[model samples]
Target: MKNIFILAFLSVAIFSCGPGSKTIGDTSSSEIATNDTIKIANEALEYEVIIVEPGFDSWLISQPPRGYYGQTKLESKNRQFVAEYNTRVLNPTKYSRNLYTEQINYDAAVDYGYEVNYLLYNYFMYFQEKYNEKFIGGRN
Candidate 1:
């Protein structure tokens, strides 16, 4: 009886700790890449692409609050391109502004890689139309 119990416990423990057993805070590289691609593509399509981090917020937060923030990743010929975008409140002092950021990733070999900039542009346009009175701006 003792031997059987030990064997059963060991078997359970081994099987429970298999390859698919992910920790609580485990973030995969694939997920990160995908997110990066989406962000880059979205930003590229909507607003001008600024490689600098500080510039990211500036572009999004304009004088009168025109656009929002976004980001994405792109895989081209085994290379990766991370895209980002943001909306700026043209006149932050005068009006309240909301800031947002997003991103996506795709396989380098795949022709249909994700475009974060385009997605961001569409998202910003949608929100701009939805909330015409409210202006948004911030750094990300």
Candidate 2:
């Protein structure tokens, strides 16, 4: 059996080698709350998607609710986003290494369910808006 594991360690923090520090978004580093971790694991399928980023939980809640988009739509979008994100991961010099920390292994044939797809899709949107990045073309 092939074990499929997808772990995405994306962060909102900016590192600088200077006197002052840099931050993402409006809120400063101090004002921003603790990091949020959103994980969806399917024991039967032996695959999971873990997203650890600051303010993702609240941001996700503010977005459209589950079932807002069909599973196939979400999967399709996720596939595109994952492909672009992985490309960025490979070229850290071109892209921000902090944002694209790791590569995500998303299989199109695998049925990751609604919950997993929903969270994964939202996370990509959040990352794009927050970091000012456009993974795929067209609408987010």
Candidate 3:
């Protein structure tokens, strides 16, 4: 599947800038055996989103189900989050380079289905809570 988005762990060094930066973190056999990776694939759409952030899977499980939020709502929130996230990615000097390393390629014109939007929305929520970063105003 074509990789459309990925949230990988990056090194904490100051020089770790730009895409393709070295990934840091322990991926021991024990961690790999667990469901630490979240892969959302849509073969028909020829796109895939692989999120390898620890605790994301469990956090998602604790949240509401897929149908809890409408696709339109998810898409709206995703658009806002993606916009702010991309801005941060572009201005890494003003933000944490390690946290916002890559820009998310999300198009409002395309229909990414409900599952993808749901995961992306939740990922943003998980990201904010984990990193203590807020992309939008109001409640986190």
Candidate 4:
């Protein structure tokens, strides 16, 4: 089981960081806010996509190409990301939630995209009760 998990993580990391991979937004020492958006290369395509969120700079730095075959452990993120996304989006139920749906297509946004969206969405939602900025468009 562990080997399978490791193999899967290796595959995602390899494919993600390959030729089409892109690192965006907080690539620097400084951090970005919830409303900031940046364009980055797509993992499966040649074109770039926009990601509107924050905190990704530090999060990505902590992850690895050190897990499973010296690659990012992206495979482990889906279950967690999906769960958080579903909860934040207020899905009718766990089974009804689909991360790849047209409205919240995480695959098109890519793993990093999905991750940042989840983070931004939850952050904005948590803060909107006190702050009125209403960052509504960044979610996956």
User: Which candidate achieves the best TM-score against the true structure?
Assistant: 3
The TM-score that candidate 3 achieves is: 0.75
- What is residue 79's positional error in candidate 4, in angstroms? 4.2
How many collisions per candidate?
A: 57, 0, 0, 1
lDDT of each: 0.39, 0.79, 0.83, 0.44
Q: In candidate 2, which residue ranges exceed 4 Å CA deviation?
A: 1-35, 138-140
Best by lDDT: 3
| Candidate closer to the true structure by TM-score (higher is better), 2 or 4 | 2
Q: What is the lDDT of candidate 3?
A: 0.83
Tens-place lDDT per residue, model 4, 1-140, is 99999999999998888556446632443435433455556557444545444554344444332332211323234334444554556744542333223233445334454444444334334334333423334223
Say which prediction, candidate 1 or candidate 4, comes out ahead on TM-score: 4
| Residue range 30-108, candidate 2, lDDT tens digits | 4544347667788999997777778898888788888889999999999999999999899989998887788998999
TM-scores for every predicted model? 0.24, 0.72, 0.75, 0.28
lDDT of 3 by residue, 69-120 (tens): 9999999999999999999999978998899889899999989999889989
TM-score of 4: 0.28
Point out where model 4 deviates above 4 Å: 1-38, 43-49, 62-73, 91-103, 107-140
RMSD of 3: 17.4
Candidate 1 segments exceeding 4 Å error: 17-25, 39-140
Task: Pull out the clashing pairs in model 3.
Answer: none
